[model samples]
Structure formats: C-alpha cells, structure tokens
Target: MSENILDIKDLRTSFFVEGNEIKAVDGVTFQVPKGKTLGIVGESGSGKSISALSVLQLIDDPGKIVGGSIRFKDEELTTAKTSRMRNIRGNEISMIFQEPMTSLNPVYTIGQQLREAYKIHQGLGKKEGTKRSIEMLELVGIPSPEKRVDQYPYELSGGMRQRVMIAMALACKPELLIADEPTTALDVTIQAQILELIKNLQEEIGMSVVMITHDLGVVAETCDYVAVMYCGKVVEFADVETLFENPRHPYTVGLLSSLPRHDIDQDELVPIKGNVPAPDEMPSGCRFAPRCPHASAICSELPELETQEDGNDVRCWIYTEQWDGEKGVKVYDNETTS
Candidate 1:
C-alpha cells in the first residue's frame, strides 16, 4: 500500500457572501498516512471544519473548493464527477459529523440510518443490512445492540448517540474516516471513552482517520501527526510528540502554553492574546502578526511554510534566517509571550 491515503495541497475553499469572497480554507496543505490518524486542530473558526468539508465535497452553497487538489488513494477528488463523489462518500470515505443530534434524522430509527450506507454501498438486502447494523453498534461498544438498533437517536444518551454516529460511519468499512469533533457536548468521561473507542476501532480496522478537533489533549491521545491552523491557514505541521515538545510558530506556542496541566499549577489558565482575524478584514501580511509577540517589521510580508532541520514545517519569521527580534529567538524559548 502507498504511504499516504489522503494528500491535500494548497486547498482553498471560498464562500461568496454579499458579493465578497471569504476564504475559509486558504492554502492549507497536509497528508494522512495510511492507517494513521491526522489531527487538524485550532480554535473554532480557524477553518478546521471547512478543511474537512472540502475533502468530502460537502461544502454548501456559497462555499466551494476553488483551488488546490485533494487526492485520496491516488485519485484527484477536485475534478471527480459528482456521481463518482457520491459513490465515494460513505463507501470509500466516510465522515462523522460534529453533532450527532443534528446530523442524524430524528424521524428515522437508528437501524434505518445505519442500514442506509450498507444498502447504498453494498446493495445488501434489508435483513443483511439490519444484521450488519447491529454488529456495527456492538463494534462501537453500544450496549444491547439489537435493542438500540430499533430505537431512535433521541432515545439514546449523548455518548451512545456519538457511538451510533461512529457505527454509521464505519458500517461500510470505509478506507478513511473523518471525525469532526466526535466528542463535542459530551462530558469529560464520555469524551475520553468516545476517543478511546475510535482509536481502538481504527487499530482493528487498519483505517486512516482524520480527527478534526480543538482539544490538544485529544490530539495528543489520538493523533500521530497534527496540523495547526490559524485564520484559515496552516501555521504548523508536525508529529504529535514534536509539536508538544518543541512547537515552532508563535501561535502554536501560545496554544500549548494556554493548556492547563496537572503537572504544574499556575495562577490561572493562559489564553491566546486576540481573537482570530475576520475573513473580510484579514491582515495584508502575516495573518497572526497582530497577535504574535515575536513579530517584527519583516512580518509585514507573509512567511511561507518552510521545513526546519527537525523535520517539521512552520510558518513564522522567527524560524527564518531573516529573523530580526531584538531579544534574539531565545526569548521564545521557555518563556510565555503572554
């Protein structure tokens, strides 16, 4: 098998609202290695969800993937026909949306929705589909699979509902699974269980996963590699360990510093300095320049994503040879900018 299951390059998804084009995903690039989980993480509105939507071609009206390429198992999804895409979605590639309540049809029973995928993809009979649906529920650790299959989504608890969503996504044995905040509204314990279940299922099925979330804890626990996005662009891309241990970009550093750690007690939780820039009012140069403490006049020009000697990519002037910080780059080390 090839090393990469999904390859996305310079993906730009735009929305035309009130005659102004808003670039929700701007020049984002990354790849999902076969059978490995890649976590796309950032604060909400940083285009994390838009990047995932662009992959499955699920962007609604006014928003469309306008540039770049999404290659899944060597096939270019950008130019793939709608018919082909329809066939691919839920069969070869499936997505678990953020909210199970909103994504699932309240009118339909759990079994009905789960069977839909098997029927459409494999042309399974009603009886076989029902059997497989129950099996999926069991695989995802939902208790009393047979009983749950006959029940509606509203009848199940939040955690159970999330498991049902996972079961539905994995019913057809998709080669790739895109989970958009799988644990969103669930309590902390339930969140851990859902994440563990996904990890266990991925190992058993040997499927590549794209976990889109804002929680760094989730990324550390579930992802092998991570892509950090800010203002519709990827600011950092590295393995989970490298990212946690030695983050390069100022934005990434800020995110790590803000995370609450039990190992060290702090007076209060550190927060990122400013809100993400509005799409219409994006900075002319570096999108994060206004908030980056290490930013200098050279930041007036956008810095391209460049590979460092450590095998990670960062988009910041601090890593460049042209860095002109008065305190040198040492201040960024072991020091919180906030």
Candidate 2:
C-alpha cells in the first residue's frame, strides 16, 4: 500500500439556504494515496464537488465545513489560518475546475494568469515567469505555446482553454491536484485528450490526484481507488477493480447498472430510481433507503461502513450480522460476483 497524501475523517460541510442548514457533505471519509488517483464518483448534488472544495478550505460564507478533520501530509487543514491556507493552495495543492471559460480570467492574457502562481509561490520575476508560463503550456500539449501565452482566454477554443487551466494548475508543481469534472464540458475526442493529458502529467510529476466525476468510464480509465457517494455520504470504498467487479452497496450497484457500455448489448438503460434526497428532507435512516429496492425494516436505521472479508468497506445492512442471510438486495449487472 502507498502512503496517503490526504486523509479526511468524518467531514461534514453544509450550506445555509433559506434559514435551513443543508448538509452538502455529511460524514464523508476517504484517503488519497501518494502518486495515485482516487476518484469520487457520484450523481449531481451528491456533494462530490463540495467535498473537494472542503479539502482546499475554499468553502465560502454561508457554506461551512461544520465538522471533521482534513489532514494533508499530516498537517491539519481544517484549522489552518487563512494566510497559511493561501500558501498551501497554489503551492502544494492546486485545482482545475469544471469550466475553464469561467475559471480563467478573461481580462488577462494566459501568460499573466499562469505567472501569478510562480510570482506568488516561487518569487519568479516577469521575464522568468513568462518563460516558465510558456513552458507549462507546451508541457500540457498546447501547440505554439509562445503565441498562445500572449493571447487571452477568449481567443482559445474550449479544449485549448481547458488545457490552459491544466497548465496553470500545474505551474507550481503541486503535490496534490484536485480536478473537479475536468472533462465535463469537452467533446468526446477532447475529453479523451484531456484525460490522457492529466494521466500522463500525473505519472510525470508523481502527484496524487482526487478526481471528482459522475462518469464511471472516467473512473475506470484513470482511478486506482474509487469512493461511491450518495446523499452526501460515502456508501462504498474500494480499489477500482474490486469496485467494478464486486460492488456491495445498493447505490454503487445502481450506478454501475446505469452505465452505457459498448461491450454489453442492452435495449434500455437502467437508471437509479428517485432523485438524490434534499439536504433538509433527508430520510430518517439510510439516505438511500427510499430508493433501495431491498430496503427492509432494519434499513430505517443508518448503517455504518463495515469492512468485508475481502477488505472493501460498504455501508449497507445487507452485509451485516443482522441481515440473517435471507434478505435479498437486487443488484443489477451482477453476473460475475464470486
């Protein structure tokens, strides 16, 4: 096993909307191993993005990380000072957001934005910063980096702008890279290129990555470990291969069943029933109980994440001693489980 670069325990982030405290990330715990990628897979509103933000201490006013600890390289981040956190953000941990068009400053040239990280963190002068900025763009596979650095974000195409975001994020050689839906806005071909770029860069720099995405295909292609989250909590945590092979949680099963596979011939896609529960309207017991096909009376009580004999952790009553071995949870696409 690799050493962990980030360890989060019982993280709970919430937002105050309309005088109601809504839990966006509730009791989430996971670890990203050094030089490896951990994918947090969940549907929209599953708190995947918020969990990543909480790690960087970027939760704004009205949205707070109410509880839990975030330890980055054994340093506690939840209590870190603003100045210290700022230093940590671009220097040690950088994030590539979903939309480069919005994340990149339209008013500034690409070179200016990229150089900011170097100037602040590394104290590079204008000439040296510009040289380094062009190098980064080239490193991320942006053709004609010399010309591109002088251009504004609007002058670039969507894929090129996204590449710029990656260049900026990696300018400081951060130890951890948090990419939240990095390929969400790109076309299929561009998405593949972006994903490959991130993977190659990760291997080159030896940095740990926390990939927040709803696409299972992306998870399979890039992740070493996987965390399946639902209704703001982690329902399943396992190695990527184990997760796709032997998913134990109902929500995980549902997500796998919903994937559109070219190898498998399916007449209809099987989507998970019901939408993610609203934070204020969370159910009394297991958050997924309402939509779980196998939910029983015992499901009225929340289940803890329990480690199975195979070492995967799953949060479901079906795997516990109280299950009595008779109750069945209908997991789809489960033809190969041992």
Candidate 3:
C-alpha cells in the first residue's frame, strides 16, 4: 500500500453557465499522506471547496469534473460508480462542511441524523444505532450526549452543532476526513477548542485530514504539509515550516505579508492589491500576472509548477532559468502597489 491515502493529479472541475465554461478547479494536484494533515489555503473563489466536493462526486447540475484523476487508496474516484461512491462516502471517507446548520436537517433530531450513518454503513438497527449515536456524541465532548441526541439542531449552540457534525462524520470511523472551514463561524475560544478537538480526534482515529481554510494561523497550527492555491490552481506546495519560513510563489508571499504579526512590529499590514479576476475573463497567461509585483514579459506565458532545488514546487517565472528580468530577484522583498 502507498503512504498517500488520497492523490489528486491534474484535476479539472468546471461549471457551464449560459453556454460559457468556468474552470473552477484547473489542473490541480496534491497528495494527503496517511495520518497527516494537508492544508489548502486561499482566498474565496480560489476553488478550494470545489476541489474537495469533486472528491466525493458531489458536483451538482451545471458543474462537472471535466478531467484529471482522484485516487483514493489506489482506487480511481472520478470513474467510480454511484454505488461504489455511496459505499465509500461516509464509511471510508467523510466531510464536515463549512456551515453546520445548513448541512444538518432541521426537522430530524441529532440522534436521527447520526444514526442514519450507522444504519447505512454498518447495518445497525435503530436501537443499536441510537446507542452508538450517543457514544459518538459523548466522544466528541458534547455536554450531555443522552439529552442532546434527542434535541434538534436549532436547539444547540453553534459550537455544539459543529460538534454534532464532527460526530456524524466520524460515526463510521472513516480513514480520511475533509474539514472545510470547520471553525469559520465560531468565536476565538470556540475556534481554538474546535481545532484542538479535531487534532485530538485525528490522533485517536489515525485518519488523514484535508483541512481547507483561508486562515494561515489555522494552517500553521494543524497542517504538516501546505498547498497555497490562487485563482483556480495550486501555485505553491511545501511543508508547513518551509512555506512559512521561505514562501517561493509571489502569491504566497503576498498572503503571508497581509497577515498581522505580533512577534514583529510592523507599520501596517501589506494587503495584496487588486481583485481576483472573473472566471470568464481569466488571463491567458499567468492568472496572477496582473497583480504580481515581479511580473515581466516572460509572465505573458504561464509557468509550469516545477520543483526547485529546495524540493518545493512553485509556479512562478522568477525561479526559472529563462526569467528575462534581473537574476535572483527577491520576490518577497518586492513591494506590491495598488
């Protein structure tokens, strides 16, 4: 068996609207090692969530997986039948969506929702399912699992509801878990608690995690590997320490510069200039060329994601030998203007 639990290569997912195609995830590739966390970080409209959705074959109408491969345990997921996907979805792989209230059915009690997973995956009856449901609720550290299981989603706090979502996703003890902005809606304390809970649970269950978030702090805290995405592609990929210490891609540098740092005194936060281009109006060359500080004539052509001497992958012209500009130009030091 391979060390990687999930491997995505050149994956493309697009949406057809008004006879035009929007490439939401354009030739994206990454790997998630077993019992480790991989953080996918980028701003909104960067295809972070779309890539995760494509893994479960959950793309709705007007959207489809156009090309590339999604391999889970050496099983090709893009061509997997509906029945096969159904068996894999909650039993071997699970996901916790951004919002808990919207994902959970309001009409059903939390117990009913949790029990359904056990019933479908393990063939457990109502009595046995309910018994396991309460145990799962307790495992996630819910205050009163016996009472909370019978209550509706609307009856619990946001943090509690999120815990219920985690419990539901883990009910089958999946080998892989995809957490999409799990702590986005919580307060600082609650967010910390939720992250800690996930880390503890991951250690307990020994599952690989794909953590999708825009927060760099979360990436630093939880991720072992990092993939910095921009627009619709992965611009940089490296281990968490290498990424923070020496980010190769200009977009990654811009993102790190924008973050507020208490360790070092700064005059102001350096925000990346300009808005993300519309999907239909994407640049023919490098997607970030319009906003990059080091963009040159060579940037008129898109650069391939190539490995550098340091063994990190970066999609930028500055690192290439054909770079027409000054040799060894410091992208991190270059100041971006509005």
lDDT of 1 by residue, 1-338 (tens): 45899999999999999999999999999989999999998888999899998998999999999999999998999999999999998888999988777778899999999888789877888999999999878777788999999999889998788888887887777889999988766678767767777777688889899999877778888899999999889999999888877788888888877765333344666787988888877998899988887778999899999989978899988888887775456424554422
User: Among all windows of ten consecutive residues in candidate 2, which has the lowest summed lDDT?
Assistant: 329-338
TM-score of every prediction relative to native: 0.90, 0.90, 0.91
The parts of candidate 2 lying over 4 Å away from their true place are: 118-132, 138-144, 261-267, 328-333, 336-338
Clashing pairs in 3: none
Question: Residue by residue across 1-338, what tens digits does model 3's lDDT show?
Answer: 88999999999999999999999999998999999999999889999999999999999989999999999988999999999998898889999998777888999999999889888877899999999999878766687889999999999998889889988887777899899998777776767776787788789989889999877788889999999888889999899988877788989988887865323445667889998999878998899999998899999999999988877799998988889976778876533321
Give per-residue CA lDDT, model 2, range 17-116, as digits (tens): 8898899999999989899999999888889999998998889989999999999998999999999998898789999987678789899999999889
For candidate 2, report its TM-score: 0.90
Deviating ranges (above 4 Å) for candidate 3: 118-145, 157-159, 260-267, 333-338
Model 3 root-mean-square deviation: 3.1
**Model 1, runs deviating above 4 Å:** 118-132, 138-145, 157-159, 260-267, 331-338
1 or 3, greater by lDDT? 3
Better of 2 and 3 by lDDT: 3
- Candidate 1 local distance difference test against the native: 0.85
